[model samples]
Structures are given as C-alpha cells and as structure tokens.
Target: MFRSLLIANRGEIACRIIRTARQLGIRTIAVYSDADANARFVRLADEAWRLGPAPARDSYLRAELILDIARQSGAEAIHPGYGFLSENAEFAQACADAGVVFVGPPPSAIAAMGSKSAAKQLMERAQVPLVPGYHGDEQDADFLHRQADQIDYPVLIKASAGGGGKGMRIVERSADFPDALASCRREASASFGDDRVLIERYLQKPRHIEIQVFADSQGHTVYLFERDCSVQRRHQKVLEEAPAPGMSAERRRDMGEAACAAARAVGYVGAGTVEFIAEPDGRFYFMEMNTRLQVEHPVTEMITGQDLVAWQLRVAAGEPLPLSQEALGIHGHAIEARIYAEDPDRDFLPATGQLVYLRPPAESDSVRVDTGVQQGDAITPYYDPMIAKLIVWGQDRAQALARLDSALADYRVLGVTTNIAFLRRLAAHPSFAQADLDTGLIARHHAELLPPASAQPALPALLAAACWQLTGEARHTAHPGWRLNAEWQRTLHLGYHGHPLAVRVTHHADGRWTLTLPDNSQHVLSAERHASQLTVHLAGQRLHADCLQHNDALHIYLPEGLSVFTLPNPYAAEADAQHGDTHLKAPMPGRVVALLAPLGEPVEKGAPLMILEAMKMEHTLVAPGPGHVAAFYFAVGEQVSEGSDLLDFVLP
Candidate 1:
C-alpha cells in the first residue's frame, strides 16, 4: 500500500477518505482553500497544504497545483472526492504524467464517460440499454428546437458535459421549450463551462436506481448491489438507500451485469457509479456514469460491509479485488439523508452563515454522520452547502427509515436555516414509509411536505421561550427580590417569521405558571427543567421538549418540528415589513446574474425581472404586481447584500 495518500478535495468527503486511509495505516495529506484552512478535514489529516483562495477555481479546481503538492509531499496517490476535480479526465492524465497514481478510473475511461452525449453513444456501442434521446453535436438553437419538437413535449434538456441535476430542465409544453432551453443553457455554461445540451424523453414516475461498481488494476471488476435515489429536490437527491426496496434477485443481477459491462466497455477502474432511471414495471434505462465516488455512497457501505474508500486505496496500489462478485451480498438495509444548509421553505435555496451551534447525532454501529464542518464553522457561498450525510442501518427498509427519522429529529443546527425539519417530515412521510417513491415525490406531495406556516407558536414552544427569557433575567440581575416570594406577570417577547409574538406569563411561588396567548387562549403550565431539557405539563398533558437559548434566539424542539424564537426587536421587524411591502430586496445574499426588467417598461404581476445567482443556483426575481420599471440600483454581475433593494418600481 502507498505510505502517503493525498486527498484532492475538501469537506466531508475529504474527512471520510482520511478516516479510511488512517485505518489502513497510511498517512493522509489534505489540501484546503483559504476558507477551509481551519476546517475539520484539515485538522484530521497527517499533513495539510493551502491550495489558494476560497473560490474553487482558484484553489481545489487548480489541478496542476494539487499535483505539484502531491509530488512535494511524496504522496503516492491522489484521491479526488466526488466534486471539484474528481471527474476531470485531464487532471487524471496529468497525475499519471507526474507518476502519481490517480485513485480513480484511467483517463481514457473518464474521458469516454465524462460527457453525457459521448457516454450515451459509447453505451450504445457496448450494447447497454439507453434512453432514447438526441445526442448530437449540433448546438444551433433552431436545430435543438426541432429535435425537441420531434421528441414531443415533456422532454428533458440535459447538459452534455455535467450531471447532478445541474443544467437540466424539463419542458412540459411545446410553447415553453425555447425559454427552458435558454435557462438550461445559461446554467450549464456557468456550472460546467459547456452549454451543449441533449434532448431525451422525460420519464414519468421514474425511480432512480444506481449500481456501485468497483474495478481493480488487475483487470477485475464487480458490482456491489444498488442504491435507490428516487427522492429528490431540484433534481438533486435528498434520500438514498441500498438494496432497492422492491428489487428482485433476478433483476438485480441483470442491472448489476449491465453496470459492470458499461464500466468494462470504457476500461474503468476504481470506484464509480452507474446510474439508471427505472419505471415501476422493472424496466430500466441508462442515465449516466459518475466517474468518481457518489455523495450517497455510505448506504452502499452499510449494506455490503465494505469500506469503499479502503478498496480504492488497495486498487490504486495495483492490488486485486478484495472480494469477488460472488462473495458480496446484501447484509441489511441502509438509508442516507443529505443534511444541507438550505431552507426548504424558500424553494430550497442554499443558505450561508456561521454554524452558531451544531449538534449532530453521535455515531454508532447503526448511526453515522459524515461531516466536514463543526460547531462555529461558517458555510460560505463559494461552494456546496451540504452540512453532512446522515446514514443509518437496520434489518430492513422500515427499520432503517425509522432510525433515520429519529436521528434527524435529534440533529440540531442554528444561526442559519437548514432542512433538518424537512428531512424529518420526509422520512416519516406515509408514502415514503410505504416505499411509494419516485423522482417527482417531492413535487407531487409539495403541499403535505411543505405546509403553510402556522399563525401562532405551539403552547409548549411558547413556554420554553418564556423560560428562556426568565432564565436570562435571573442570570443578569444579582438580586432576586423582584420575584422572590411573589407572583409577577410580564409580557413574553419573541419573534417568529419576522413578526412580534407577545404573550402574558405569570410566575408564581410554586413551579407553575399561567400563560395567555396572543389570541387570548389560556394554558396552565408546569415545567420541570432537567439540565438542557424540559418536561412541561401544559394543558393537562406531559410533554418533553429539547430547548436551547443561543445568541438571543430560543430554539425549542418538539416531536413534530423545531421552532426558533428570537427576542423581539420592534425596530428590525418594522424595517423588514416596510422593505417587503415597498420594494423588493434581495431575499438571500447573491450576485445579480442578469437583469430582465427593461427600463421604463410596464410589467404585469409575476413578471420575471432579474436573476440572482446565489449558493450556486439561479433565482429569478419577479415583479409582485403590475408596475413600471422606475429605476435600477444594481447592474448585472454586481454582488448584492441580503435585504438590499435591487430595483425600485412604480406600481400602476
């Protein structure tokens, strides 16, 4: 085995690779950008080097610099984790030229499979079943439109050079094809520097299943079963599991063999994923092959009792396959949930900020957390905002999902918004529990999945906020004479959804209280504190809630969901309301990618006016109502501050 291995990546995957390398008694080297100097992955490696600035193009994506660092550090191999330079075939070839083993497929395989159109053609020549589509090189707009019309409506426009749902759009109507194509092309160019796209027949209720294939330098390759990645948001998978819920033994073998054949067709080596789109009838079509490890690889690891990272190390060291295809069998069911720094309520837009307080569930045999961040880590807008990958194993899918839901509820993050609550609801969703999964699951049940905001906070959460306020008062004042043997009533001030929430609370000599809601509802409260938790007896029912007070925000976690209440700031609230009611300010921090509003042009309600690119996704800003473009404050490509006005318009 190579004595020193360099991880050419950052974040959770980098840390994940280091863990396996250390286990095999190999020294690990980590490379980081300026933003990740103090990141968890950096601290975990035996040696670390700074690549460049925070932006990926200046740092992690600098393939030449990474190769030089590996040579200087005497690293025998470089492991490119999923994103960044992982699938860059040119980098792989460069590593080979430097005499450093690239712990992935040979450059020839990567080059053959890197482009979607090329890969589809190669798969066709190799006799692998493929989805019918137009994989041509003609990039003329008219030509593409004709292809779309021929394929008919409800076709998928996919970027020829990228995956991960980026640069992908689904056109449902012939009239919308042109606009969708424009948007898809822009996104593809920005994401992969390639605007070339192909048209394909869209799948209705498609279940995404992928085979995990591994190959060694000894010309041996095997498939370690499959993972169902059907649940998605914005085309990115949200939930994944191994040993697909309804996969038959015969079908599994067929798909497995097809995946291996696809890999061998390109002379593949190391770890790669062959993804497929399957219908309910068990018929599947080839989608694309990821030339590196996948974000949801932990599910495969749990079911097969294999350390895929370790396998990569062994394979890169010219070792034979660790376990043959016959020896690998599904041991148990496993599921993985990707925890991201995003707001599911806000179109699942990525969020950026300090991780004020993060408490992931402790790891064990059945529960695991793969994270590149720790408490106080800042999630910047320069890269992907995935916080962690939460994986759990059980005897079956039901048990695995149940454990996943429980673990999600236990996880906590503050300072910035996250999708933990959304994840919890998704896992416990009735359809999901029954394995009624599809790629459109999130969109189909959007109403039930993302319910409207409640007008008032729950009684338990209100009590917790009251306790937080009283505790702070108690800690700050030296004398307790104000409430010492007497009852006192005061307004509990808190803010939720940018609105002030005031409730009347009366504290008595006994460990009991009377609470009145804003709407005049009353409740008798008896809360017993146990360290950081509380057992509240409210409305004659005993309920346990996890509560924490941090940085003026009182986070009360209930069995159903998490509610955060901040000390009421009337000034800030008024400002926010006025900003929304008067002019449209930037919802989230991002750069103005384009301006759609023409000067002095009258616009109807919901007219697209501008596009803000933030957190690596484009968000179109629309006119709230009929209005005339009165003024422009920011130009295209200008960085706009959150809550700042982008333009001012006169309502007609």
Candidate 2:
C-alpha cells in the first residue's frame, strides 16, 4: 500500500476518501480552494494545501497546481474523487508523468470512455448491447434534427462529454426539437467545453441500473453486483439501492458479465461503473461508463461489506483482485438518499446559505451518513449543494424502505431549504414502496410526491413554537407579580412562508396556559422544555417537537416535517411586499449566461427572458406577463448575487 496519498478533490467524497486512507495507515493530503479553507475535509486530513480562489477553474481544475502540491507534499498517489479532474484524461496522464500514481483507471481507458460517441462505438465492437441512436461527428443543426426525426420523437439529447445530468434534454416532439437541441448544445459547451452531442431514443419507463466493476493490475476483474438508480429529477439520481428490488439471479449475472467485458475491453484498472438503462422485460442497454468512484457507492458498500476506497488503493499499488466473482455475494438490502440543499417545490433549484442548524440521524451499524459539512458550515454556490448521503441497511427491501423513511424524518436542517421532506414522501410513495419504479416515477405521481405548498403553518407547530418561547422567557426573566385571580396575557407575532400570524397566550395563575390561534381556535395546554426538546399536552394528547432558535427564526421539527417561523419584522415585510414584478431578480447567485428576450421587445407570459447558470445548472427567467425588458442590469457572463435585479420589465 502507498504510504502517502493526496486527494485531488473536495467535499464529502474527499472526506470519504480520507477516512479509508487513514484506516489503511496512509497519510492523507487534502487540497482546498479559498471557499473550503475551513471545510470539514481540510480539518480531517493529515496535511492540507491551498490551490487558489473559490471558482473550480482556478482551483480544483488546475491540474498543474495539484500536481505540484502532490510532489511538494511527497504524496505517492493521488485519488481524484469522482468530480472535477476525476475523468480528465490529461490530468491522469499528467499525474503519471509526474511520477505519482493515479488511483483510477488507466488514462487510455478514461479517454476511450470520455466521449459518449466514442464509447458507443467501442461498446458496439465489444458486442455490448446499446440503445439505438445517433453517435456520430456531424454537428450541423439540420443534420441532427433529421437524425432525431428518423429516431422518432422523444429522443434524448445528451452531451457526449457530460455526466451528472448536465447538458441533457428530452424532446417530446419534432416541433420542439430545434429549440431543445440548441439549448442542449449551449449547456453542453458551457458545462463540458464540448459542443458535440449524441442522440439516443429516450426509453420510456426505463430503470437505471449500474454495475460496479473493479480491476487489478494483474488483469483480474470482478463485478460487485448492481445499484438501481431509477428515482431521479432533472435526469439526476435522488435515491439509489443495491440488489435491485426485483432483479433475478440470471439477469444479475448477465449484466455483471457485460459490465466486466466493457471493463476488460478498455484495459480498465481500479474502480469504475458501467451504467445501463434497463427495460421492464429485463433487456438492458449500455448508457455510459463512469471512469471513477461513484457518489452513491456507499449503498454498494453497505450490502457487500467491502471498502471500495481500500480496493482502489490496493489496486493502484498493483495488487491482485481481493476476491473472485464467485466469492462476492449480496448480504442485505441497502438504500441511499441524497440530501441536497435544494427546494423540491421550485423545480429543485440549488440553494446556498449557512447551515445554521444541522442535526443528522445518529449513525449505527444500520444507518450511516457521509458528509463533508457540519453545523455552521456554509453551502456555497461554488460547488455542488449536496448536504450529505444517508444510507440505511436492512434484512430486506421492505425493512430498508421503513428505515429510510424514519431516518429522513429524524434529519433536521435550517437556514436554507432542503429536500428532506420530499425524500420522505418519495420513500413512502405507493409506487416506490411497491418497487414499481422508473425514470418517470416522480413525474407519474407528481401530485402525491410534491403536494401544493401550504399557505399557513400547522396548528401543532405553531403551538409548539409558542410554548417554546414561553419556556425560554420563563428561564431568563423574573416572573411578574401575579394578580390574585387574574391571568397574565402576552401576544406574539410570527410569520410563516410570508404570511403574518399573531398568537395570543394567556398564562393562568394555575399551571395551564391558553393559546388562541389566528382563526380564533383555542387550546389549553401544559408544556415542558428541555434544551431544544419541547413536549406539550393538549386535550388529553401529548405532542413532542424539537425547536432550534437562530436569531429571530425558530425551526420547529415535528413528526410530519419541519416548519420555520420567524418573529415578524414589520419594516422588512413591508419592503418585500412592495417590491413587485417591475424587475426580474436573480433567485440565486450565479453568472448570467444568456439573454433570451431582446430589450424593449414585448414578450408573452412565460416566454424565456434570461438564463442564469448556477451550481452547474441553468435556470431560465421568464416574462411574468405581456411585457418588454426595459434595461439589462447585468450583462451576459457577469456574476450576480442572490436577489440581484437582472433586468427591468415594463408591462405592455
């Protein structure tokens, strides 16, 4: 095993690699940008070095700087963890040229699989089944459109050099093919610096399953079963599981062998994943091969009882395969949910803010959380907004589903929106629990998975907040002299989701208190507070909640979900309400990539106006109604902060 290793990445994957390296007695070195100077991964490494500014192009993507750091730190090997430079063939070759081992597939293997077009060609020669589509070099718009028409409508436009759902689009009809193709190409160029694309016949009701393959320098390769990544949004996975819910032994063996064949064709060494799109009848087609460790590898680990990172290290050191394919067996079912700092209600737009309060479910033999962030850390816009990956294991798929739902409820996050509630709903959805999953499962059951947002807070949450406030006040202030037979009264004003509410609390001379809701409903309750936990008794029923107070905002955690209430600031509320639709503001801090509508041109409602790129995704701003953009506040390619006005609009 190598004595010293440097991780050429950041975030949870970096932290994850460091944990395994330390277990094998390898001194781990971490590289960070300015934004991650105080990040959790940096604090966990044996030695740390700075790369550059927060932007990836200046920091994590700088292969020269990283190679210098590896040489200066005396690292024997560099582990590129799944993103940034992980799949960059040049970077891998550069590491080899610098006399440092690259703990991934050989540069040749990476180059072969780097482009979808080339990979499909290679897979075709290797006799691997492929999805029928166009994977050629012709880039003319008209030519691509003709190809799509021939393949029928509903073709998938994918960037030949992209992964993680960026630079991907699904066109449902020939009428929309031109615009979709143009938008897809632009996004592909911006994301991967490659405008070349491939067209695939979009499979309806397809389940995404990927086989995890490992290879050693001695030419021994084996498959580690498979993971079902069917639940997705924006073409990115949200939930993944191992030993796919309904996979038969015969099918598993066939897919595993196919994955291994692809690995052997490229002389693949170290860890890699071959993704496939499987039909309902068990027919699967090769999608693409990821040439590095995957983000959801923990699910495979939980079921197989193997440390994949350690495997990577040993293989890079020229060791033989740890175990043969016959010896590997799936032990139990495991499921992983990716908790991201995003709003499910808003098309899953990424969110950026400080983690004022974060409490994950306690980890044990059955439940695990892999994260590179902690309380008080910031989820910046410079990197992926993933908070953590929560993995749970059980004896069967049913038990795993139950445990997943429970763990999601126990999670608590504030200061920024999260997808915790949405995850819980997804796990509990009838279609998911029954194992009837597909790429369009979320779209099929959108109403149940994503319900309409409530305009008012729940009664129980409001009561809990009021009781928590009263208990806090009682601890700090001296009690007012009570009248012989009169009750003391106090009114509190709170806001929930922009709606102002006022609750009246009447404290009786006795022990009980009365709380009147905005609807004039009354509840007589007794409450007790212990730190962040609050228990309330009302009308012979007992309710418990967790309250986290940050500044004037109170985060109330209930069994159903989380509710955030704040003490209303009259001045700020008025200002926010008055800022109407006269200007279009950026929802998040990002660079303006395109201006869709010309200035002073009247556009219909919902017409695309501008595109702002943030967190590796593009969000298009639209006209609220029939209006013309009067002026552009920020030009294309300029960065704008959250809530900054991007343009001024005048209603026609």
Off by over 4 Å in 1: 473-486, 498-500, 519-521, 528-531, 535-543, 576-580
lDDT for 138 (candidate 2)? 90
With a 3 Å backbone cut-off (N, CA, C), the pairs that clash in candidate 2 are none
- Score each candidate by Cα lDDT: 0.87, 0.90
In the range 306-411, model 1's lDDT, one tens digit per residue, is 9999998888889998999999999989999999988899889888889988999889999999999999999998888999999999998888888898899889
Look at candidate 2 and tell me the lDDT of residue 363: 96
Best by lDDT: 2
Task: Give the per-residue lDDT digits (tens) of candidate 2, residues 343-432.
Answer: 888888899999988899999999999999999999999999999999999999999998998899999887789999999999998899
Considering summed lDDT, which 10 consecutive residues are worst modelled in model 1?
472-481
For TM-score, the strongest prediction is: 2
